[model samples]
Target: MSDWMVTQTPLPRRRPRALSPLREHLRDTFWFAPTAAMVGVFVVWLVAQELDAALVRSLRDDGDFDTLADLLRFADDAKTVVSAVGSAMMTFIGVVFSISLVAVQMASGQFTPRVVRLFVRSRITKATFAVFLATFVLTLLVLTSYDSGADPLVVASAPLVQSVLTLVMVALSLLLFVMYVNTTLRLMRVSHVIARIAAESFRVAALMPLPAQDGQAPALGPVTAWVAHEGQAGVLRDVHIARLVRVARKHGVVLRTVPRTGDFLVPGTPVLAVHGGQAPPRRALRYALSVGVERTFHQDLAFGLRQLSDIALRALSSAVNDPTTAVQALDRVVQILATLSRRPLDAVVHRDRRGTVRLVQPVPGWTELVDLGFTEIRACAARTPQVTRRMLAGLDDLLLLAPPDRREPLLRHRALLRQAVERSAPSPADRAFGLQPDRQGIG
Candidate 1:
């Protein structure tokens, strides 16, 4: 089935050179620029001092001719020692600066607050500091034997120090790289959580049985067996029925049960036949609602906002033919979108005057329609500001497909939905439901 299909799209390539110049400059300057500048300055000063010393020695030209050769050899040896020390110091500084810069950026407001809290509470910071300090102390010990008098110690310790420092640097680098990857994964997981919640909310709002004032049961149209198992006759307990009853009560549904034990039932055979109600509550809705009120509210709000946003955009496009007006509508649209930005979207069932029930857009099953609506809105926003006849047709199609029972609730909540739609269209990060440029013309 189409519902089970997973369409994989290639990820967008990274465009490092295409990034804004200012952003690129900031990234380069934050960690590397300072260290590079300091190192360059130090090297230039050292080189100038060495050149002056050599010039003075040449000018003196003492009677002891071997003095020049000894001074030359001493200078060469001193350069080697200084180079080694400088290299180690530069490596250490680079590592420290990189870590600090990355950590600070991660702590910034770019990610969810939960992610920031998780990273801040991590013990890796302390562990990293300890590793750095140990590396520093070991490097200092190795450099201590650089005196000429300790020739044997310097010769033996030099290679050992180099080897140890190299290994330490490699290990530290790997550790930092791993930490960065872990932080990225954590942020991704947090984003997924929000997306999943938003998706599920929309699904619930589109699929759940509509609320009714009259306690009438809905007819069981086609009961697809989601799960089937034969158990003991006593398995059908009062508790199970009570739970179903509670769900019915919440949705203003009435249930009548004719007790049957271990009876063979077909797909369309209603276990406890319902009547005078909207759609029957599915297991998913029950589970979602069971979580808690806050979650339910979040889910419902998100779904509602998404639906309203799509509807409003479609309506606005059909009404206005001008691009400027369409974009202007977005400003009004933003108000409705805001209410749903942080909330979850859920299904809300409604029955029509014709006594037929159908699911609406902004729900999981109506993904295709929602996508179409999103495309229409984006097109209108980009190309025309005025609503058009075509946009109205799209809105009409959406309204026509919605369950008839929802008319009253919708009319009653028209203002609410309008406000939400105006406020809740997709933002930059929440563009999963937005139109894709490539797919725009196709739809």
Candidate 2:
């Protein structure tokens, strides 16, 4: 089977990236890993300073010196080279910092703004920055130790040793700079960006339970109270299902989310329904749910799909008029929809460790997921033959490859696509060709 064919099959549900909101935010930040690396560099430089000083003193004291003297470069030469390298490192670090910011901006503008988080959290960017900064620091510290007078007690070896290390780091930094540029370039491509988003959607799909299960959902009683949100208005990014379930079970009540992930949660809106009269503190429930200014893919599987679809829609717009980009986006969207087809599509019910359902959270059904993946692209492709043909082919491909349970949704979407093409095509022949389920849009 091909990659998508294999991917279309559902796997066992996997754990969520963050059981809570704090961890999720922490995962997206820029400085955490690089800061730790910078600290390590600082400590290493400190230790190396002492070692360099000790080596200098020992070599000077040995005085059996011709070999020792020749082995070490002059203090002035060492200082000059290290200083020059330090300036270069500083300049490069500035360039890297600027380039990173530009890359983030480009990614945000070209792809979805959510992708900015990916660039910021990139390890390569952080490592490259850390390496350059470390070299600068090492050189600066060694420059202070450059003493020309042979005090015998005073060791000039520290500068020489530090210079050698600085040279090695300079070479390493040069190599890493090439790799960093390549990574940045790859991130800019729409194909790679779409593929990455599709892969992430699959990974997140594993976080939810399969749509069909033998176990029944817990009985949801009349809403005893409505738990209103108490923060700045924003999108409900994700709900900690396990924690919500635990909280509900602990209080012997049932809870159902009023708004799903990606839904806007206003400050005074009822975010959840509490049954059995007793409700947990608004703070506790709020903590269990993450509210952010924008949606993220951590729990909202549909957000990634929406982003790719939006990209395709824009590409197909009259302003962009890039049907090829639209086709590229649709290709991944089809695979992503196929992958979601095998995953559980119904509302997710969270059961406790003993398997008693306590919380019911809704997700997009098969029809909704299919609409999200194809509706915009299909609409935008109405006037473009190549894109229209690809959309038809994508639907047909899914119809053939997706499992039986997923076929109904694909069929519905395929029907929608035919109707759209029939209505929007410029002529009778174009409409007829567009409605066909062939790759080239010919009847």
Task: State the weakest 10-residue window (summed lDDT) of model 1.
Answer: 288-297
Best candidate (score: lDDT): 2
Model 2 Cα lDDT, one tens digit per residue, 158-189: 45556677788889899889999998888888
Clash counts for all predictions: 50, 1
Model 2 residue 5 CA deviation (Å) reads: 23
How do the residues 1-443 of candidate 1 rate in per-residue lDDT, one tens digit apiece?
Answer: 11121122222343122233233223323334434434543444345445544543453454344544444445445545544654665476466557655654653333222223233323454334444444444344434433444332112222232333435544774585467556545534424323333444344333333334343333434433222222322222111323454555555543433222212334334344344455354662342111111112222333333433443454345443333323333333333332222222222233444443332112233333233224445444432212322233333333454444323322333333233334445464323222222211223
> Against the unseen true structure, what C-alpha lDDT does each candidate score?
0.36, 0.74
TM-score of each: 0.24, 0.83
Cα lDDT for residue 332, candidate 2: 81
